[model samples]
Target: MAIGLFYVILLGCVLLNVCFYFYFSKVCFSNPTTYTKNVTPVSVIVCAKNEEENLKRLVPQLLSQDHPNFEIILINDASTDDTRFVIEEYMAQHPQIKMVDVVNNETFWGNKKYALTLGIKKAVNDHLVFIDADCEPASNQWLSLLSSPLKNDTTIVLGYSGYHKAKNSLLNALIRFETVLAAVQYLGYAMRGNPYMGVGRNLAYTSKQFYDVSGFMSHMKVMGGDDDLFVNEAATGNNTAVVIDPEAFTMSKPKQEWNKWWIQKKRHVQTSKLYKTKHKLSLGLFFTSQIFFFIATILGFLFGLQWEAILSLVLIRYVIVWIVMGKGLSRFRESELIPFFPLLELLLVFLQAGLFISNITHKPSRWK
Candidate 1:
């Protein structure tokens, strides 16, 4: 009976992984063609808080975008550092740069959503593109490629944002690996016409859509939902699109310390509670399957259950993962991480389990 139970668990894990592979093979194989000719004017809004150095490095790239008509709106969110001065200096040189300063009120402490709302209101163009202060465009054509999908009546445009490749550290590898995995899931779902979330580091949408969905009012009190939650609330299957062109990618600085990354991830996980029911169930199933797969495979081997069947199931799953994930890695320009996927995949299963547990008891702090 115990051996029979092992077979049941092992088969369940194999079946779940097979479902994921089938989804990847069917929906996420092809890259969407970008529309570059009918580019519309865009307002690129960036919210910054004491990121003077990054602003200096990345803002100029935004200014030099190859697009024909676009404005860069920099929101200085009551930054105590040289953030304001840096923007002032850029404004002096660039005619397209606009700066909105949010003074820090002692009695009323506002989060990132407040600053973003101000920027959206202040935007002159109908289309608004959002990115973090620390993000740098992968190419001069970033603006053109990112905004092109909007011409096709796509209300929400999701672009890829990855961390710059670091030298040597397991933490860095884990960060990059997890990021690639997320991009695959979100982007793949968008391709499958079940669009759910997008990253603010490189996301675009129309002002009309923002106001139509009431713009983050649903979860305004919670910090860190400004991107994913807003997309979840606003995006629909036909209205959303995903762009994975290399030129559309935005690279951001990765968190170096373990504690910092953990806090950042915890805050992000907290927002999952508010995701649409369909998305919540789908994502939950994927993670749960991953944990069960790894755990069941180990037990099957240790308990000396059907050795031939166990080996066959495990090998088949790995092959499927490699083929599907290999194509996804190629599309996202994350080929280097492909060799490390096996080890990282197992580690992430355990890590995600811990994060989900911690999420239930932890209270999220204000977004920095």
Candidate 2:
């Protein structure tokens, strides 16, 4: 009887997970929405602190984006380095380049939202695009496609931001896998008119939309949600769009050290805790099902109760995940991780569990 109950729970988990996978699978074969070409003037905002080196490389790419009319606003968030000098040099060379010099206010030191608020206030354009200092556009069309979806009704655009593929590093693979997986969930959800969040690394909104939600003022006290929290509070089926165009992507540097990555994940996890009630419930169910699915697999094998059935169910789940996430990875340019999909997923499950526990005991560290 105990064995039967275990099998039942395992079956339920697989079924639940597969249902979620089926939902995500739609994103692969789905043309969820159609967008008209938008040539509205866009203001590209990037905020940075002590990132003089990254800015030197990233700014050129931002400047090179093939758009009719756009301004690049570089927000130097009180960097102690030569970040201001780099921005000044670029400002002198290109009429399109502008800088927001954020004087260090200890009260908001290292606060990204505060820094970004200053930059956004100074932008002249109504349509806005945001990119990170440590990132480069995948192509000239980045700004073009990312902004094309914007119109009177569509106020928010969620774009994909990927990492540079590092060779022979398991940690790198793990980070990329996790990132693409996240992209899958959020993008898949947005495809169905349910956008919960978006990464700031490559995202867009109208100045009106930003101000509509009071421009991050709702979650101002919390750190590390200048992009996602705003979306959570503001985006809706009527006003949000998802951009998966290959050329529309942005690529950022991933953390190399495990400790650094752990810290980064902690901050992100902390921010997610503030999602709206319905979003929390929906996401919590998906995550809980994931946790139990793996736990059941381990117990099923050890207890030797219908091992064959367990194996079959697990394979079915894996195949579905493989198909869905495989398509996503290919589109996102991280197809090389496909072969290790199952293993990477298992690692992520465990990592997520650890992160949750870590957060319980340790307050999330603020991003600098």
Candidate 3:
């Protein structure tokens, strides 16, 4: 009887997972194959600190984007490196590129939020598009693709950010898998009218909407509120839109080492505490379900605790995750790694649990 009950629970979780997956797949995302022409005035904001190397490549890519009325604002965030010098050189050549210096600001302690705020203050355009120094848009039409959604909703536009392909290591594969999974969940949630956080690597918002929220006051002292925290505050049901179009995607470099990756993940995860109550509830439910599934599967296999029942339950859990993640990867062109899905799923579950525990107990994370 216990064995039968275990399988029943496992199958129930599987059905729930499958239902949610198909529901999101049908409602949340539409293929972004349709391209729209220049319709909105855009200002691209980039915040950089000692990112000279990445800036050299990423800036040119921004400049080359096929948007009609947009200016690139690169904020030099008091870097001890040659980031300023390189931007100066680029400014000398490209008249369209503008540079803003964010050194010695007293009102706002030095952070990316302050730097971004300064740049936004100087922006001359109505639409505000933000990307990181370490990211590049997937296509020249990237700006147009991201900005096009604003015509329908002026409040928020969330775009996808994935890691650039590095040499095929398990680390790179896992990072890519995580990125795809996040894109699916966040975008999928938005489809169901529950938009939470967005990645800053490629997000767009209006200056008016940003000011209305009072902009990051809730997480001002936190190390990583600039992107996710800001999104948590700014997004709403009627105003927020997710653009999963290939052209709108921005690609970033993954952390090269596990320690660095862990720290980054922890810093990113810390902002979840500041999310709105609804977002918090949804994320809590999702995470709780994941933990329950993971634990129940483990307990089942150990001590012959309904081995068949447990395996069936675990397989159901895996299938649900696999289908959702697979749909996401397919849309993002990451299907190449589908063969390694089992390893990727296990690694992510392990890493996510470890990171969540550490985030709850660790010190305020530092960027360096």
Q: Rate the local accuracy (lDDT) of all candidates.
A: 0.86, 0.89, 0.79
- Model 2 per-residue lDDT tens digits across residues 1-368: 88779988988999999898888666676653546656789999999888999998998888788888999999999888999999999999998888999986777766889899999999999999999899899898889899998887989999999999888999999999999989889988888888899999999999998887789888887888998899999999889989988888899999999998999998888989999999888888999999999999998898777888999999998888789889888878888999999889999999999998998888754568
Which candidate comes out best when scored by lDDT? 2
Ten consecutive residues with minimal summed lDDT in candidate 2? 29-38
User: Which is better, 2 or 3, measured by lDDT?
Assistant: 2
TM-scores, all candidates, are 0.96, 0.97, 0.92
Global Cα lDDT for candidate 3? 0.79
Off by over 4 Å in 2: 31-35
* Clashing residue pair totals per candidate (backbone < 3 A): 0, 0, 0
RMSD of each: 1.5, 1.3, 2.3
**Which ranges in model 3 have alpha carbons more than 4 Å from their true place?**
1-12, 19-23, 27-29, 33-35, 105-107
Local accuracy of candidate 1 as per-residue lDDT tens digits, 1-368: 87788778878878887797677453348856757553688999999999899998988799788988999999999899999999999999998899999976653375888889989999999888999999999999888888888855688999999998888888888888888778888888888888889999999999999999988789888888899999999988899988888888999999999888888989988998799998999888888888888998887788777789999988988998888887777777778889988998888788888887888888677777
Which candidate tops TM-score?
2
Candidate 3 lDDT tens digits, 316-351: 666766766677788887988787887787678778
lDDT of candidate model 1 versus the reference: 0.86
* Clashing residue pairs in candidate 1 (N, C-alpha, C atoms within 3 angstroms): none
